[model samples]
Target: MTNVLSFEWKKEDYVTISGMIDESSDFSELFKKNHEVLFLDLKNIHRINSSGVRKWVLALDKLKDVEIHYINCSFSVVDQLSMVPEFLNKKCFVESFDARYVCENCNTSQTVTLVVGFDIQAGEKNYTDGPERLCPNCKQKMEFDHNPDSYLFFLSNLSNKKKTAI
Candidate 1:
């Protein structure tokens, strides 16, 4: 588990969370008592455990009325979104997240940023079928690291929220 200092509050309206989200994370203080919208920045988060998932669910339960917008969600966060059905809640929305890719030749992995309503086009959830990226380390074609159907399952819920017409 990473240190509790991974959570940071800013402007009394937004919270930026980094590092691994484990039992050590203090999500209680991160949620404000009075706020219409809370922008959560998960850009730097890399991991979340079962305990962290439980804590995350409980924390969101407390903010039922608050509109939470998730921004810069890493691959770990994406996994949570897929596994934990209530993790995102109805009031929450994902703005952008990271998609993983790897080079078979070099075994190099990279994360590509994908916006909820942009990079993930409607009726085209499989990134593997999309454009191929050049591996930064090996200069070879990089493949999607995880199964598209499983990795992008969370997007199904968001597809109707801010979807861009194709």
Candidate 2:
């Protein structure tokens, strides 16, 4: 069975989206109001397709005037953000997201939350310097699973945008 997308409004401007974001997902509510800042929680979003990406990009276009903060983004969402330039607009910011880590000793893998400004620094070459994480099984240091440069590439784009906007 396909997991249908769902949204929960935690506040007037904060909404949590879960399940799969596909062509059928409706984003009409996001464009209904004028908000100074909108917070979107995407930790539960498990999957997204090409049509979904197109639909999401179109929805974001309508929200260009609003400052969007993406919080608790899952690895899937991060993948989209890193791969697609249009996935993150100038008005959008990623507050926090999950990154995959693996322990080579025990072959254990886990996901850790990384806050943009705190855990991640824009110009820093070592993106893995965030909170020290140890593997649950082996009690050994876990290394970042993906390439730091590629997985965190969106930060460079965001940093460049901020510099030009200043």
Candidate 3:
């Protein structure tokens, strides 16, 4: 069993949340209370689903101009986060905030990332865990892996897009 804690508040038209986030209404209702940036805190959260992604998208649509953020999410959650369509940066800032580059060949339909971490500097960079997505069957670098391009892609584009953007 897991203990779930959540955080949500309207800060100048933004719903700030920090805790377990699933396909629950604790957020939609908050949206109804007031439309703002849907700030979701994945920092302490452990799990989520496509349904959770759907909920975030719906909330963003209904609220319009609402920004969603999921911080410090687990790697599994981060993997799912990366695959969500239109989900991007403003909503998916991995703790330690790392940037991942995607291979321009796999086409995103057949890539599965095993581990993720990164380091960077002016005109240079470094990352561990094989660059975000790999072929689940071939053990080779995949060209693409659905959407999200990276975890940050999810937090910034969680609504009205739902697919790879740029």
Candidate 4:
């Protein structure tokens, strides 16, 4: 039962959020203010849920002009969001890479198939961890999958790997 906490902005044009953005968040009010860029500063945010994601999507649609960006998101948040295609597709922002491959050109999501509970490893090993290779669909080199606790670090932000363009 953690309570949601955040700051209210009126004219900063950049909204930074901390704390949990759960059901208690004031999404409606935040959307009404009309910010040009919404920086959901999840730097200190510990977690999020279905309700929170719904609110974010709804607010995103409302704030069509607002360029949304997420910061300091935890691996759990990244994995959860990747699991939800609707939410993943809506976010046109680049992630810090804790287990998602965002196409540089199309911005499409390419998540690794979770090999837990089904494909048990012969020993203590994470199945998600595989050699890095180019995605067959996009032909762009995708980052290797990581353990849930490990954070995926990106070497570069500028990636639009298309064979035609190369």
Query: Across residues 48-112, which tens digit of lDDT does each residue of candidate 4 receive?
Result: 77787776667667766765555445555555554654443333343232345545554566654
What TM-score, computed on C-alpha atoms, does each candidate reach?
0.78, 0.86, 0.43, 0.50
Clashes of 3: 27
| Candidate 2 residue-wise lDDT, 22-113, digit = tens | 88988997877888789999999999898999999999999898888889999889899989999988898888899888999988889888
Minimum summed lDDT over a 10-residue window in model 2 is located at 157-166
Compare candidates 2 and 4 on lDDT and give the better one.
2
Provide the overall lDDT of each model, using Cα atoms, as 2-decimal numbers: 0.76, 0.82, 0.43, 0.48
**Model 2 scores what on Cα lDDT?**
0.82
**What are the root-mean-square deviations of the candidates from the true structure over C-alphas?**
3.9, 3.9, 10.9, 13.6
Candidate 1 lDDT tens digits, 55-142:
8898898888888888888878989998889888888888888877889899998888876655665335454442467899879999
Q: How many clashes would you count in candidate 1?
A: 0
lDDT of 3 at 70: 47
Candidate 1: residue 17 Cα off by (Å): 0.7
Which wins on lDDT, candidate 1 or candidate 3?
Answer: 1
Q: List candidate 3 segments past 4 Å from native.
A: 1-5, 8-20, 32-39, 89-166
Candidate with more favorable, higher TM-score: 1 or 3: 1
- Candidate order, TM-score descending: 2, 1, 4, 3
